[model samples]
Target: MAIDILSHRDPKVATDILKIQQESYAVEAELINFSDIPPFRDSVQSIVENDETFIGYMIEEKIVGVLAYKEEQEEIDIYRMMVDPAYFRRGIGESLLKHLFATMPNKPVVVQTGKGNEPAVNLYLKYGFEPVDEVEVEPDVWIVMMKKAQ
Candidate 1:
């Protein structure tokens, strides 16, 4: 499905992000269980700021996925990532990840997901990310951290 991942930012991208999160994440997952997640009513404006830290993926000219990261002093930390439910499992997420890796020029990348998020863990592992640690952020809720060396 001819997809394009761009490094541009606009208001609609944030709106799309909220929709994607609502669609992709299960209610009980730690990814959503945390108060960190924005409610549907909140706009994605802050998240879509055209900072060097942001990247977005478009399919057929429509925003379908996005990831946000920061190039830190020692490593690249992926703070946010999501794919449109309608477009999940179509390699869009994978392509965006590969694009991020290529764009980062072989830096160490780190990501975190909920322990119950098997799909996310599997996807990260498939792309050479290894589980490095786990932290309990809430009662019975844990964050599984992984890293991939470029």
Candidate 2:
């Protein structure tokens, strides 16, 4: 897989990222028993306007995974990380994360994932992200916030 920076002005790239985001976040929603997760509510236009930088993982010229983040002061807040379910277990997510770490070696990274999404939470833990907090976004739906310091 190869990683490429995405252009927000490119409608096609934004559309592709939105598609991946919806597909991936749907699983998280189910795992956490919440259907109103932010990613599921995002539109292509909103994605284009987000101001976060997006990096896409391409396999055979097709985008199969994407990672989005924004740098704030000393921290990088990861807004989204998604891999096509078909591409799960293929290391695409890891590559995207490694790209982020390599590109911004000194910045602390922060992310939130559904507390019940073991795969995602485990992946973050494996990458050295320590669980720092949990927030209940809805009645019983909790998101686990994690961070990795530089």
Model 2 lDDT vs. the true structure? Answer: 0.90
Best by TM-score: 2
Clashing pairs in 2: none
TM-score to native of every candidate shown:
0.80, 0.96
Write the residue-wise lDDT of candidate 2 on 1-150 in tens digits.
Answer: 689898865888889988888889888888888888888778888887889999999988889999999999989999899999889999998999999999975988999999999999999999999999999888888899999988
State each model's CA lDDT, in order.
0.71, 0.90
> Best by lDDT, which number?
2
The alpha-carbon deviation from the true structure for residue 33 of candidate 2, after best TM-score superposition, in angstroms, is 1.4
Indicate the residue-level lDDT of 125 in model 2: 97
Model 1 spans with C-alpha error above 4 angstroms? 1-9, 26-42, 48-52
